[model samples]
Target: MKIAAEDVTPVAFTVILFLAWEGACRLFHIDAFILPAPSAVFAAAAHYWWPLLKNSFVTLWTTVVGFILAVVFGITLGLVVGWSRAIYRGLYPVMIGFNSIPKVAVVPILIMWFGIGEIPAILTAFLISFFPIVVNVATGLATTEPELEDVLRALGASKLDIMRKVGIPRTAPYLFGALKVAITLAFVGAVVSETIGANAGVGHLMVQAGSNFQMPLVFAGLLALAVEGILMYALFALLERRMAGWAFRASMSAAG
Candidate 1:
């Protein structure tokens, strides 16, 4: 019953939040241009449903494509770095430097090169998200117990054998955790890039609406983004629990 109540808490709180927002707007007689109520946002969404759907699809695909690339590249690079102390040390600083730079700044350069389209958005998503995966995966492998490694070595296990038998499997939880984070970052990157240059997307739609003083439509675009982001994040959270159930169980046991 406690677990069930805990599960309902977020939904309940979200309902309360929207109710409060609507009441506040009504009580203050807030200008719609400044802060459209949830009802106004929903009405705008229903009215512009088709454009929202089309642009949302565009954003979704771009984010997914970029996230897929980030996963493949991040996992492969992480494995290579984690395989050796020297390589990891040498590459770590470079990766830090790269990740520290704002991805929004990179968008203009991408636009210049790609000439305003989905490609830039995809690349932006890839660049923004790949770092966390790389860090988490490499950390997972690098933190493998030295005592265990010695035991494996004593049993005549090679480095490759240890990595295949232990390191990769141990990193599964870390990889999935990073995926949840990276997927959200990927959405941010795609939207940022689209807002900067793309001809179509939720970001672009919001920009257009804002310029036209259509605050309700602009807020509706934001609502669309929030819904999509929540769904994607939830999907990965479910995947993490499913794929790394052992890790979850172990952590729960440890906590208990």
Candidate 2:
């Protein structure tokens, strides 16, 4: 198979970025404690591969668990809220207020209730990631074209039938879009909770490395997190395209 420019561009840019960063550090004689070169980071990763792998797995599982819970709960709540204008209006403010609060603030409370473990990380991820999903699904349902609903009703369709045939289908693109956003947020939430207090995880490893002034190790932890986040986001993006290809094509065509 031939390589496409779109695929090559990101790889080329990433290489350029790392090369520039490494050159700048060498030229400026930057202290390793303040900012380790990419080479040092990779060396740390190689030396501590086992620990990094174990911690990365812990973080990945916790993030996936939390994200799955968010998807189920968010979709259910969004549907309920979007079923009626009154419910949507009443719940919107409460949701907004809750989402506005920094999730980092809630990490301590979760840790207190769940103790220092994966449970806290999971809950923190769920809390931080569900908002966008809820909003997108609700908006998609609420904005269903009235004319379409009228035609369905005129054909003797019940409210449930209209919802089943129209509202749910319309919400697919929105839900998928939200999934891409939520996955990233879930990673943030999980890592934040782990950093606050955890026995194992990339976040915990980073904290230990930082305490020991192992800047390269800390950067390796960050690199692991970045790689995981990018992979997860890409997975969801691919799913979105596969499942909602028509919606995506329409969007692209419109933009063009």
Candidate 3:
């Protein structure tokens, strides 16, 4: 099969943007300490490949663990709240309040409670990423059409049956959308935890580099993070397409 124009357009644009960035830095003779060229960043990554990749794995593991916890708790609570007006009325406000809390502000407290270790890091990631999943999942469940509910009811379907067959299937796309956002937040939480108190991981490396003014290494760490985020976003996007193919197809048709 041949690549479509639509696909090639984005790849071309990305290449152009990268070239522009590389060219601008070189043309301006920017200081390495201030803004190193992309080439330098790539060199740095190659130089410290083993250590950087190890740190990346540590961060990746923490992010994945936190994401799993967030999805489990968020989906369970979301389903309960969505299915019951009484539960929603009583708990929505509290959930909203918790989400409104600045995640950064809670880092110190998290450290104190969970210790300056991976637990705090994972908990921080979970907390930061959970709200979106909860809200999106609940919204997906609660927003089912009245006509659809009526049709199911007329078919003698029980509440549990409706939920399992209709609600969850419909809600999956939104759940995956929430997952895309959650992945980035999880990474941020892990990095923040490592930067503040932990000994290993990319965030710790970044902090150490910054203190010593090792600009190239700092840029290298940042590049690693950016690549990780892109990979995660791509992974979620692919999964969404696969698991929610009907929803994706409908969306595409609508857009077209």
Candidate 4:
């Protein structure tokens, strides 16, 4: 099989960026404590592979669990809100107000309730990620065409029938797009809560390394997080392509 230039571009760019970083570090005689070079970060990762692997897994687990919860709850609520104009109008303001508060501030309250553990991290991840999913799904469904609805009514389609046949299919692209964004936010939420309260996770490991002036390990932890986030985003992107590729094709055809 032949590899496409599109597939190679990001890898090439990343390599160039890292090479530049390594060169700059050597040229400037930069202190390792300030900004560890790529080599130093790699060395730290190799030296403490077990801790990095363990903490990375812990963070991934919490993030995935939280994201699952968000998907279930978010979809359910989005459908409810999208079902009616009154419900959508009544709820949008409250949801906006809630989402507006910084998630970090809510972490303390979660810790107080859950007592500084994985629960707080999980809840924080759930809280941070669900809003976009809800908003996107609701918007998709609520924006369904009135002309189509009238046609469906003329054809003797019930409200539920129209929703099942049209609303959800149309909403799939929006929901999947939301999923990609939500997963990243979930990771952020998990790591933030871990940094503040949890006993284990990449965030906690980074904090410990920073305290001991282990800048290389701190950067390695960051790298682990980036790898995880990228993998998850890619997974959702793949799933979106598989599940809603028709939508993309339709839109492209329309544009053309």
* Most accurate candidate by TM-score: 4
lDDT of 1 by residue, 17-49 (tens): 999999999999999999999999889999999
**RMSD (Cα, Å) of model 1:** 1.9
TM-score of 3: 0.92
Could you tell me which residue pairs clash in candidate 2?
A: none
Superposed Cα deviation of residue 106, candidate 2 (Å) = 0.9
The residue-by-residue lDDT of candidate 2 on 102-175, one tens digit each, is 99899999889989999999999999999999999999999999999999999999989988999999999999
Error of 4 at 98 (Å): 0.5
Can you rank all candidates by TM-score, best first? 4, 2, 1, 3
Model 3, runs deviating above 4 Å: 252-256
- Models 1 onward score TM values of 0.96, 0.97, 0.92, 0.98
Local distance difference test, candidate 4? 0.96
Encode model 4's per-residue lDDT on 1-256: one tens digit a residue.
9999999999999999999999999999999999999999999999999999999999999999999999999999999999989999999999999999999999999999989778999999999999999999999998899999999999999989989999989999999999999999999999999999889999999999999999999999999999999999999999999999998898778663
**Pairs with steric clashes in candidate 1:** none
Least lDDT summed over 10 consecutive residues: which range in candidate 1?
247-256
**Where does candidate 3 have its weakest 10-residue lDDT segment?**
247-256
lDDT of 3: 0.88
Error of 4 at 120 (Å): 0.4
